[model samples]
Target: MLKDLAIIDYEFRQILLAVTIDIEHFAKIQLLDKLEQRGEDGYSIVSSFLESNDRCNKDGSVSNYVKTEIDRGKSGCYTNDLVARYPSYDYPVWEFMELIPFGTFNQFVQFVAGKYSDKKLRNSFYRLQSVKSLRNACGHNNCILDDMKSGRPSYQVSYDVKNALRAAGFSETTLKTKMSNERLQQISTALYLHHSSASDGVVAAKGDQLRYIVKRMYRNIEYYEKNDVVKSSFSFFKQVIDAWYFNDD
Candidate 1:
C-alpha cells in the first residue's frame, strides 16, 4: 500500500512538471504576464489573493508557497542549477512552475489553461484536481484504500475519464457504481491523467512501476479473495493499467 501510494505521488509530480513545462512552451506568453492582464490592480490583486486565507480566492496566487520556493532556489537548496540562474523574484513561468507546491501548481495549470479555448486542456485541469488530492493523501501518509464504499465523493467523476474507462471495457454501470467511492474516483482519475497527459517516456516508466505494484498486490491474492471491496478495487485498477499501458492492441 505504501509503495503504491509512493508511486502515485512520484508519478503525479513528474506529470505535473512535464505538463507545466509544455504549457509554458505552448502558451507563447509568460504566465505571469498573462495573469496580470486579468486584473485592474495587476500584481497586487494577484499577490494579495495568493496570500489571502480566504477559501474563495479562486484566482490563486504565486506569492505564498512560490516565493518560499524561489528563496530556496536562490539559496542553492535545490539540486537543479537552473533555479539558481534566476537570482531574483522575477522568475520565468517555467521556473515558477517548477518551484511551486503541488496544489499551487495545479491551480496555476487551471489558471493558465482557462486562457485558451481548448476544452480538453480545461478538462485536464479537473483531472489534475483529483491527482492533487491523491498526491496530498500519499504525502501525508494517509491510508488511500481505507474506504471503498460508494456515495461519498465530493464531486462527480469527469465525463472524459468515464468514457475512457468505458472504452477500456468497463460498463457504464460499473463506472457509475465503483467511481462513487472517493478513493476509487481519485485513484482512477490519477491513472487516467497519467495515461492521457504524461510524456510517452514517463508513461512507459510508470507503467513498469505499476506492473511491479500489481505483481506484489497479487502475490497474496488468496488473502484478499473473499474481501470483495479490496478484491474489486484492486482488480479495477489492474485492468485499467493493463488496458492503458500494457496493451499493444
Candidate 2:
C-alpha cells in the first residue's frame, strides 16, 4: 500500500502543480490560486484544477508553446478522451458529474466554478479514481511509488496522473518541484493515517469513504489546537471521524 501511495502522492501532486502554474487564466482557477497564494498551507493547486475549465490547447499542451522537444510526444489526457468517450459532442465539464464517483469532483468544481460545467467531470473523476487507489496502497504500508514499489504502477495509473497533469498544462519541472515538498509529504502521511483509521484500516471502500477522511481532518485540528495533545502526532485512531463535524460548520 505504501508503494501505491508513493506513486499516487507524486502523481496527485503532478496534477495539482500542473493546474495552478501552467493552465490558462479563468475565473474559477483564480480563487484556487488565491488559496495557495494566501494560506501558504493549503493544497489549492488541486482545488483550482478541480474547479476550472479543463480544455486543452490545440497542441495539447497548456503552455501556448512547447519549450522542450520531448514534450511533443505526450499523449492526449484522459479528460479529453473522457469527453470524447461520453457525451460524444463537444461539451463542458459538468455534464458527466454524476458518472464520477463520490460526486466531490463535480461538487468541488461547482464550489469554485460558481456554475456547473456544460461538459463532464468524468476525466477528472477517473484521475481521482487513481488517487484513491494509490491512497490505499500507501495507507496499508505496502509499496512505494517512485521509491520503486513491489508492484509498479499499472500504465493506467501512470497515465491517469500524467494525463491529468498534462490536461492542466503543467511542465515536468513544476510538477516535480511541488511534489518534492516536505510539507506535502507530511500532509499525505497524516491524511493516509487518518483515512485508514476511519475505516478501521479498511481502505477498500469507495467514494463514501471520503466522509471518514474529511471527518478526521477536523478531528486532527481539534486535537492539536483545542486539546493541546502534545503527543508525537502519531495517534492512528486519533478521534472519531464525522462529516457533520466539518460540513455542519
Candidate 3:
C-alpha cells in the first residue's frame, strides 16, 4: 500500500498538472478574446487590474505574482558571470493563470458569457477549482483520502465524466456510488479532467496505469491491512478501483 500510494501520488500529480496547464491555456485564450473584443490594450488593462487596490487578494493574485517576479529580477534571481535570468513569461499564458486566484476563474466564466454561447464554460471553471484543490493535495503529498473527505469537490460527475466511466464499463448507478464517497471523489475528478483535457490515447494509457496499480494493490492487500490507517484508506479506494477495473455492467 505504501508503494501503491507513491504510485498514486505520482500519477495523480501528472493528471493535475496536465489539467491545470490546459486550464491555463484556456484562460489565456478567453482573456485575449475579451481584450480584443473590448478594443483594450492587453498589457495596460491587465496591469491595471493587478495594480488596483480595489481588487481583492483573489482578484489581484496575478498582480502579486508579477510583483514577485519583479522583485526576483531586482534581486538577481540567476546572476552569473556570463548569464542573468529571472522568472518571466514571453507570452504569459500559463504563468498568468497560475497568478490568478482559483475563484477568479468562475467570475471570468460569467464575465465572458456574452462572448461565448457555451454554458459549459461555467462547469469547466467549477471543475477547474476542484482540480486546483486536488492539485494542491497531490503537489504537497498530502493524504488523498483525507483531503477529499475534508474538502468539497468542485464539480459533480458530469456527462463528460459519465461517458468516460461508461466507456470503462461502469453503469450510472455504479458511477454514482463511486462518486458519492468523498474518499473516491479525487479519482472521479482525475478521470474527469483526464477525459476532458488529455488525448484519447493518453487517457487510455492513464486508465490502464490506474487499473494496473490497483491490481497490484489488491494483491498486496494483506500488507496494507497490517496498519489500521492504511487498511481504512485502502478499503475506501479499493471499492472504487474494483468497480472501475471489473465492471459487471
Off by over 4 Å in 2: 1-89, 95-231, 240-249
Better of 1 and 3 by lDDT: 1
lDDT of 2 at 81: 55
TM-score of each model, paired residue for residue: 0.69, 0.22, 0.54
Q: Pick the TM-score winner.
A: 1
Q: Give the Å error, residue 233, model 2.
A: 3.0
**Number of clashes found in candidate 1:** 0
lDDT of each: 0.63, 0.34, 0.52
On a 0 to 1 TM-score scale, where does candidate 3 land against the true structure? 0.54
What is the alpha-carbon lDDT for the whole of candidate 2? 0.34
Q: On TM-score, who's better, 1 or 3?
A: 1
Model 3, range 122-233, lDDT digits (tens) per residue?
5666555666666666567665643332334344656665576676666666566556655466556554565455555655555565666556546666765656655544
For candidate 3, give the lDDT of residue 101: 51
Ranking, lDDT, top scorer first: 1, 3, 2
lDDT of 1 by residue, 1-249 (tens): 446534543554454344334333333234445555644233343344344423433567333555555566555656247666655444445445566656666666565565455465567667767776766676656666656766767899999888889989998777888989887887777777667655677678767767766776676667765678777876887898898889343
